[model samples]
Target: MERDLSCSWRARREAGGHAKGGKVTSSDVIMVPQIIPTDSVSVGRAATLALRCTMCHGARGMSEAYTPNLAGQNAEVVYKQLRDLQLGHRKSAIMGLHARNLSDQDMRGLAAYYSYLLRETPPSSLLGQRKAPRIIQVGSPMFNIAPCASCHGGSARKTASSTLEGEPENYIRAQLSAFKDGTRHNDINGQMRSVARQMTPEKVETLAKYYSQR
Candidate 1:
């Protein structure tokens, strides 16, 4: 089915009826142009777009290794990430190269395509049922040193920040590690670095495991 993306506004006539020389009573419906999806392209382009994403994000936009799971993500978020990669605001050696080659339309197409895939939640094992090191708990302090649920759960989760649900444990841990150290420093908001710096190796593992299990 086609989607209609538009904003609706309500209008009403003045109260007290139309005055002699003051006002007029009238109501009307106005149609504003909206950003709607048009089938101006072919399936071949879609297939190629998916293939381009699959080269790193996996065939289904779900990476098994250190890469993130992009399936079922918000289209805007995906588009922003692609733009960040291209602008050097996000650090990804491989992604940077790939994004640089894509046009704005290509990025949008990929984002829209991937946003429809099934979203995978982190494994339950990482949600904190298992025992973890004491240092991690002490150093991190919030969410038992686990950071996924904090920003990605409440109001913060709905924002531009990527959701942690259904992501691979290894990928989460790697990112945390990268943020903690100086290996990755392209966060436009600097939140990742701030959060990662407080985490030690033990904390990283505990949190990673916790998120994995969620």
Candidate 2:
């Protein structure tokens, strides 16, 4: 299909004709199919890549404290982060090295590979969908904290924001701590920092455990 498309596109370009009836433009480039199908990035291949990635992140994209778990995360999110790292918008020595060498296809493949991984759910999740913990469900009005569920996709729905369900507990704890300390300011308008600032240490730990178990 790709070969045929390429040939057709070349023929059209050489003939100086528009694409069928419509005008041809750079946007038409998207009409060309990728050499590799998105579905070809399988779990096994992802795991193999993860092995190369396991020094800091685990074999399943589960990393230690302060590292993110890539399993079951949104593919676009992963792709954007990789792009950011490559462009120096985000800073991480390890990620910068990995992203710098990757082509656009590699980023997409990695995204698809990690997005499809199956994460283990806690027993509570098996029973049924669960609600966010009280702290996440109801924001502290006095402190001007927004409800975490509103933006993080809540416990009931997965949002474009990173999915926290079944992620490593330590990672969540560390991130919240970072947000509180103003060390991590990636969130737009300092939203995470604001929310974390209002949360006590005990509350932060509670929120971490609540989502980790889900």
Q: Of the candidates shown, which would achieve the greatest lDDT relative to the real structure?
A: 2
**RMSD to native, candidate 1:** 13.0
Q: Write the per-residue lDDT of candidate 1 for residues 63-122, one digit (tens) a residue.
A: 776777888776656766776577554577888998888876676666667777786654
lDDT of 2 at 189: 43
Q: Once superposed on the true structure, which residue ranges of model 1 sit more than 4 Å away at CA?
A: 1-47, 121-147, 154-156
In model 1, what lDDT does residue 101 have? Answer: 84
Clash totals, every prediction? 13, 0
lDDT of 1 at 137: 32
**TM-score of every model?**
0.65, 0.68
Best by TM-score, which number? 2
Kindly report which residue stretches of model 2 are placed more than 4 angstroms away from their true locations once superposed: 1-37, 41-48, 64-66, 125-131, 154-159
